[model samples]
Target chain A: MSALDSVPTAVSRPELRAGEMLAEGGEGRVYELVGRPGTLYKAYRRPAQLAPLEALIAWEARLAEAQPELAARVRAATAWPQAVVTQPGAAGGTAAGLLLPRAPRRFAVRHRDGTSRLATLSYLTADPGQRAAAYGLALPAPVSADRIGIVYALARVLEAFQRAAPPVGHGDLSTRNILWSLERGPEVFLLDCDSCERYSPDGEALDSGHRRRAMTPNWDDPATPAGANPTLASDRYSLGLIFLRVVGAAHFPLQRRQRDSELLSIDFAIPPAARRTRSLLDGAVVWSVCARSLSTRDPARRPAAAEWVSALEEVLDGLGAMSAARAVWAAQGGGTPAPSPTRSAEQAADVRVRPVAMSGAGRRWERVRPPGPGLPALPQSTRPAPPAAAPTRTAAPAPLPAPPSIVELARTGLGRGGELWLGAHRATLASLSRAGRRRRATRQVIGCLVLDFALLAVIFYMCAMVAGVLLGI
Target chain B: MVNVEERYAVFPFYLCLDASASMAGTPMESVNRQLPLLRAAVGEDPAVAEVIRFGVVTFDDVAHTTLPLSDLSLVEAVPTVVAAGRTSYAAAFDHLRQTIEDDYHASRGKGDRWYRPAVIFVSDGRPTDDRERWQSAHSRLTDTGWKRHPNILSFGFGDADPAVLAHVSECKPHRAFIAAEGAEPATVVPELLAGLIQSIVSSSASVYSGEAQLVPPEVPSMTPIPVDELD
Candidate 1:
């Protein structure tokens, strides 16, 4: 059965206008709507699969009236559905998807393979040291201020979302779904609101096909009911796991101790060897939140999203603003830092990185180990020790206020057709891209988008043609 | 503030196959079809895909890495194999040593955790290379360095030499297998592929939580070859 098909609230959308296709997901395809820049049309693969489109749109429409204060904040914080896009049945179309104001560019970063995905807090958390050093991957500078900034921003967004009139709930929350940008301090982008859970006519949870979204056997919250749909408490549990991934260890401390391998999760318990790094974040705010949320076997006992916001705010209060908190750590770094070289640094330098032959050289048996056992310990350097101190707190001299959002755009314009808006803050899009550079980047992105969509269209057409020939349609 | 550094870890799996003239025609055709099926089977399961990376290397006159580790997800079709030249064991071994060294560190640089790599070598004919170069490369590939070393499994079919294949399966005597000479290409190739997929999936399941030892799952129908007769 189609997902978005035949909802009781299934009203045809007039907003489904002509548009240039932009990108495609398994369930839906996205388009840049005609006459509308910075807005997209998501056409569902199985139009019926997007049944919740009406619910999300209706929920959002009610927000301005229900909670005026949070309406604007919620709108800015997420890629919530603004309107639904419909295709006429005469043209062989159904209830497709939504018309969403595109998330700003800065929310995404390019992967090694040149494709860009929404940048998430997980990117910063991965191989924080070596990956950062070797591949130029970035995370918040190993500073508490930067890390705390990420938590505070996310908590604020979650609080705003939960405080909505009906309390919007994202049924699936993975690191990939939450985008983080460290550029203008700490900013968050919560994506794919389409998959969020809403209530049916009977007020029963309307969660289906979500088992396929993001289920990790080792990492999924055990608190989730056997076959029941996602609940708000479960979202909190998942958030706690993300925090664990951010700060210290996993929900369970197990290793690949099978016949022979020891492939430890990055979130594996911090062994005594990693105690130094653990001490720095273990007793901190994230640790407390993670402990409380994860420790509870029951979801109801877990702290609410607003509580997380308050706790994080209190933590920030202890050190003051981001700059003041950073100053406290900087002062501590000045005192009793270890002499230049450590065993780990020397070991990292000693490690030999043989160059792969770009030509017809020694590239015989490229290794991709088969399924079997007996894994060895990962390199010591991959788990480098955290630095000891950054002074606790320092008073910060007040910084200048940001220029008007209009100036922010002229400084780096991001609209289509070279159009510029005053005071328009584009977060996910890189700020370095200026007038001409921004256009080039946008063109490059659009080029990739068009090629992929066109290819998909051709494949679908050919398949339909073949099916018609075979079935004599 | 804690620098909670997390390294992304991937398990490496390599298919080192002999692409000498003997493997031309049906055998090569069988591989072209089977390899893609194997990749699809493993990829359909998320647990295996997240942990195991895949690569392919074929040796005839020389060993060439036709696919890299990350190519597992990128490739839509199995690579085609063309038969020509003499099989060179040295080229395959030496290339493996160099590749393991380069790929291991580079991946680590990108913050991936390194697992003790698994290498499967299948030969349909005996190596025609000089012994000296073969020994040197063999030593490096089986150095037990853990970081650079690979857990090698060897397989033989047709007129292949069982002794040489045994040496390639460095860890133990049980890791080597030989397909029956009279076996049909279509059936044998698919069976071998099925076995390999099972090995990958089961081993990956163990990577995070299973109690089973990390032994290479034995290919079901293939016969165990004798390693004692090796020079």
Candidate 2:
């Protein structure tokens, strides 16, 4: 069966004014109407598989009435449900059509030459140079006075959104959703509004009231399912992605390959390089929002939109002050001032100033008063001078003697002999000093050894004599 | 001292989808089913419902704003998915650029400052039309002056070119592409959709308060069968 066979009837052919068909979409076909004043019209085709186009038409009309503000954002059709002739042999039914505003003639941002517009996906993909150029632009600038202002501006924007009455989430936030108008100066705009959701005014803080399953991959929370409810945290997730992209780190925390069935298994990790690129304040704000949004494997722990806003606001305020200071400093040619050692020294000395003594009993003090042309005369003291008080201080105790030095102890060296020889020498000296007493002790020992030896010798002699007698002679 | 009711928060998201002809098969169907599933999941969370907003853009022969920037609540009904078209990435890029520009202004006027939007572009084929247009538009949307660039993501299905999809997405490994291989949309859609939802939720939670430390998601290991093997 043909793709459109399920459609209730074939799309009716509209009269051609000799213009080309610029594009064809599922619901409708866009044609560039010919004439001196050309315009575009998207002719809606009635499909069988889908709901009737009339329902959509009616719904859009109602939406335009109910939310005029929103309707104003889109290029609303000037005329609706224009009838068209049906295909030959097909039932005679009118096809619906609407005239839409023509898109800009120059789609891409143009350079000064206007010849080369800004490179699109095709160019970047085809050329390495273009890719490099795009990356260079996407990467956040280094921390500098200029960057401080940018950070402040970003924070303020975040703060403003957080302070909304019923919190709002740009559910599918990304760089593609942001547009820059290079008129007079750079003006930014956000697009793709179909997925925006408003939190309940009476709901919990940052509570996303989304219950429908909705998201675009890589730019949204992987945990959120189709028909799932919306929450402010989900928007924060998209915002974090945008922040990463602007900083030139395009990939989400998980590698794209890793985003399959294991998405929940993946935890978000901010690259260290990204932190370096982001200002401390911006980094903190970004980190907090992302961390809270991605924190719980469960979505309950994520911070609400209001909470995110408040926290981010504080950071933004601080960033703003820093930026203002940096701006002033830059204006004063203080971009890179040389260090002054002398000034630092003087400040350090000032910081260490001692307190002046106020005791009246101490040494007389003479205050060095500033010199003035006319000095007020000192008032005469009416009180009588009191007698000088005795010194109220106790005398310190005398110092203790120092211990003997190692050199002095070393000087009392060992005697001529080592430890054993010294002992023997001492014994000899003692014996000589008391020769009589020492001789008596020595006699006792010598007598015992001599007597024993003599006895041994006598025994031997007696044995020899007895042997001689026995041999007798 | 602090009123709990006053502490409101909002979540912002942008979907960058690929509407190439190859996406005409089960990939697109799976994506369509998953889109509603994602919305339903978001709605389930009170916080997500209160603060989150969604937008969708489909790119095929041309980038068409199937739905402009609108609150998710406004989409009372789910959109049906129909596939049959060639891939013209340039048109998609142009549409993205235009949509973002318009939405930014609208948000500002409403006194609502927007978080940077995320874009999840899903495709199943290479850019059959002009490549220069897509590149030019991508560059302009993602350049310095426009700091809030969409976190462009590309997903490829069977027979889809990873190199081409990666080029369209801002994310890296530029080779970081997802494919259904030969799996039916019913099976692959849920997995792919679930992965996307999980990524957004985790990333948002991580940065909600300030730049809290982010944890990376763990993706399953799936050996992609070569195209030749797909028979």
Candidate 3:
């Protein structure tokens, strides 16, 4: 996996089996690679531009030889083209597809509805509250240090691509093409790398034959003129756009707005959602870099990958200092105690175990009625438990607690009242004459009334004295 | 700074179903059962759902907007369509013209820019209205002068005439489809719907590729109606 050169390039038609189709889309179908665990075969519906695919493979090989550190990052972060799958035809062969490692399991998130979905960028460019409610996964707070961390990670990956022997532009860096995950810190995985726009170091257009070098709708850089292929500048603009939308947690279209507006004095706009979060970008060098990258009509004015990298690094350092300051303040009792940054031992253990949250009845009900006939089946490991395996209620419920007697109630109530005056005064009336009992009750009532009056008088007196003292002062 | 005219792009798809008596049994049932699945399919893929706005229009002797154009992700369920009366192409076309204009303005007001809207017209019979009336309405709906004119895709089966379907699709290649002569309605309805779901998913994906296209459905039991080229 370290070197793309090691991947076997099949000259003959690869035997693709039916029913192994994992997913299908407009462009192509992805199938499980027989006996090649952790690998998948993506077959194109039409012949793909093999030249660019070959160039991409070679570029990565060169990267591995020259810059192993950056190559490792690119290898881990991208589902990069490994080898060309050519179907047997005239002369040599026609390119059909590519062989690449499957997107790792860590990239998929366990949603609240008992399913694991790819943690795509779509999850990032949404209001955190709505995203959490709809998707059942908690995102990092918008514009928080953690969110900036995500943007930084993305920039780092892009930086590696820009540093290639000949820079590569991820032409369509949209919500679907990139995946985000907090499970292993802030990280992103780029998908659909076969469509990546590549150029040779000799200033030749290596991806000229590729038809998919189109910009995604909302994610497109407005500064990139129509009919133009993606270049480093457009990629930089896209990076800035991603930073804005991801950090702001809103679909910000500042570039589009600027283009459409007739008024020349229009100011740069920040996403409204950014105001809701404690933004780490305020007065930061990263904000300036982001603004310059997005606010310019000329692509050349946009910041480079290295500039973004340095800017983001500075922001991260600031975040670290702020976090340290907060910890110190809390330790000195200047603020409420802060929670530990690392999870408790129990929570750490819990993170490794993923128990099904649904009750047995719910699991059985879901199994009894499927979502739809033609719908793709959930992975076997992710599917709910069967009815027979589920726990059932068989034993009778425990008896209810006995009701309290009137005497017990009275005793409890009297005890609660301190019962000082009424202590040792319990009587049956049978032990005394009726007239004597009546007289005793009357006397008790009068005594209680007198005590209450005395207490109220004291309270009033205290209030009056306090009022007089306040007036004198 | 304040943003003016900031809009997110939305590609609207309007499903115009023929709810004439001819579609009452399996056809109508399949439409109802599968329409919600379209919403679910779009909703599951946020990439598609983010830009795709879907609506439903059912026409018999008259037409009704069962569902207004909306982001499918926000839409909970698609309205059920009942079959009755005779088919009226004029009514369907006229209704579509008005609805598309209204939806466009409303969407623009809410900061949504639209790609050309696509109309998916599914029918089981020829237009009951007069030729002049239906043709006039169709012209109005697809008029070059209209800023919001929609790109139409026509699918027909069960007594449906290919000529009429082709005409409705403006005689465009891959724009019109008819069920193979012997295909059953029960089979055709499901396959058509399943293909439609894929077509829509693909068309929405095409937006990512920079060219938003109206990709025709690949129904297994249907064949594209040929349009003769003028010499």
Candidate 4:
């Protein structure tokens, strides 16, 4: 059946001309609307897929009525279709195109060569050196806090997409389609919103057969099979990839690596420098979410956009604390501050947040942790302690060493024996018959037999020495 | 931060123009005028220019690389081509076969991954050489065993033969186009080249679309020459 035959005639139909052509994409031509200053027209090369397009517009309208604030945020960050443009004289007024707000000037960056281009994720996903050479603009370091802020912003947008009644999947969330900017703020503007696939309110896919499902190379979700429709799961998968690539500032295919070997870890995909620099991805909370989202084949295991938002928010908060602490230290003659009594040992160990001296500045301080949203505390034994303060008055007896905190106790307790006994008291007894225990017992028996042979040899040597002395006399 | 060899995707397009004596006056002028627009269209958009590497190859009795494959944004200006000598499809095909292989390895060394190369062939006259010689060169250029064999799109006008143009494009439907009968070279040349600018821009955008395709130009003044169905 023809694509236009399925559109309902009752829908409101706006009109647009061929107009002044601006740019042509793979699917359509973007044109400037005559009277609408900030609005542009995107005319499909083939007849427009009205069902999904209308569904997206209707979905946004419903969102406006229900949640105006969220609707505004989505509208500001994305080029959502404002209306559908119809051919003036076609039968039943066939929809020919869509009118969308133009991507704002803030999203465009001027290169050193004086040509202006949209600041897409392509500018963000490469090395700082290469990006400068190619785009003529130096980007923030891969481990920069601003890069995490950008990922947090993107997660919020995807969270909004998931919040829709049926949810809309972009299907093709790639570097080229999403324009990014940190010029004004950590923001991203989505283009080609009409190409997004919509679902029925009951959570069933309403994708018609007319529109071709879009996916960009390298950015395509490895979990999604060819010819299958895009789903919320796929979108979540894409979001995970964007997070890894953007934060790492390298285009390592995490999914492809996982496909090759299920044992592959996120560490293999992450650059060694990023790992050493202790970027936000190094934290257990954020890294765990990214690992779960990409390293598994089952879509059900992937973390949702909302999960990403929370994780990113927590890490970014930790980064903020680190920055504040650094500033405090820099202000107070650049020295390592002593650990605060109120600071949990895990916070001191994991996040490395040292307590700044309040006596110098005469200001009260609140105890701060690295990140506060239920993050797992990582264990470490080799981190150096802060230097002790020099004695100014009469010498005093040193206090007994402080007892181990619960985290340190747990760590030490776990390490004392190479095995962990869970559940019952008898579990350790049961483990004694295991292969490892057998190997240990066998090694002990072999050691005792060798020791006995050595003792006998010593006795024999002593007796032979006495007999030799008697024969000489 | 990662020292990964991040290779950027590039879509290489070779504009293989027929620069025979017949194309000198209006046809050649139209090409020179329209070629710069391609640079402007691609160079202005860094997103598109990042992935597209374009070159111009002009041929008559002998073929010459008028422009080496390069990023449009990096090129200062496109050099103009002048028409002379009789048409030899053999020279064009042979030159293209050699150039594509050389270019592919050179580009790969510089960390560029390529989509299949696209060859846009434009001609105003039929080949003056024997069919066997040209066909052999064409076979070598389009050999399935060769990884760099380009997808060719043929456009013909004036004294050019539709059958040969069809053969040049391997008789692929929508790949071969001929100017409508009695259309002036001045009118046809401009429209064809203008359409080609849009075609190149659109095709380059497809590289980002996962399945890279060779999009044919929509020349309003021309019509597609239908290929005969094989028995």
Better of 1 and 2 by lDDT: 1
Top candidate by TM-score: 3
Per residue, candidate 1 scores C-alpha lDDT tens digits across A1-473 of: 33223342433556446477766656677777778777766667766544456767666667666665556556765777776656566243345667677777877766433556567544554334423332245554332455555665565566656766556567556655677665555666677787666644333465455434443334444555435566666567666556555433112222122112232222323333223432223444434444455543445666656656555544445445535333322321111111221112111111111111122221122223332211111111011011121122112211232345876666554444233222222321443355557766666566556755876898899999999999999
Give TM-scores for every candidate, taking all chains together and pairing residue i with residue i.
0.51, 0.31, 0.64, 0.63
Residues A1-473, candidate 4: write the lDDT tens digits. 33223342222335344469988877888998788779888887766656567777777877776765556657877898877777656555346778888988878888766878788887777566655554467788664666766776667677778776667778778887888777655777888788787666544667656656757766776666666666667778778778767876666544444444444433324323334333343345565566566644566556667777666656555555344323322321232322221211222111111111112221121211222211211121111111131112112212232467999888887676334322222443445456668765566556555755775797799988998898984
lDDT of 2: 0.43
The whole-model lDDT of each prediction reads 0.56, 0.43, 0.67, 0.67
lDDT of 2 by residue, A82-125 (tens): 22324344443333454444533322454322333322212111
On TM-score, the stronger of 2 and 3 is: 3
**Candidates 2 and 4 compared by TM-score, better number:** 4
- Measured against the true two-chain complex, the DockQ scores of the candidates, in the order shown, are 0.05, 0.01, 0.07, 0.03
Q: Report the lDDT of model 2 for residue A227.
A: 58
lDDT of 4 at A272: 36
Q: Candidate 3 has which clashing residue pairs, if any?
A: none
> Interface RMSDs of all predictions?
19.5, 37.8, 20.9, 31.5
Error of 3 at B117 (Å): 3.7
Candidate 1 stretches greater than 4 Å from native: A1-24, A49-51, A90-94, A110-117, A199-219, A225-228, A247-286, A320-473, B1-9, B15-58, B61-85, B88-231
Model 3 bad stretches (over 4 Å): A1-19, A23-28, A43-68, A81-97, A109-115, A126-141, A164-172, A194-229, A252-283, A294-302, A316-473, B1-5, B88-109, B126-152, B161-182, B202-231
Best DockQ among the predictions, by candidate number:
3
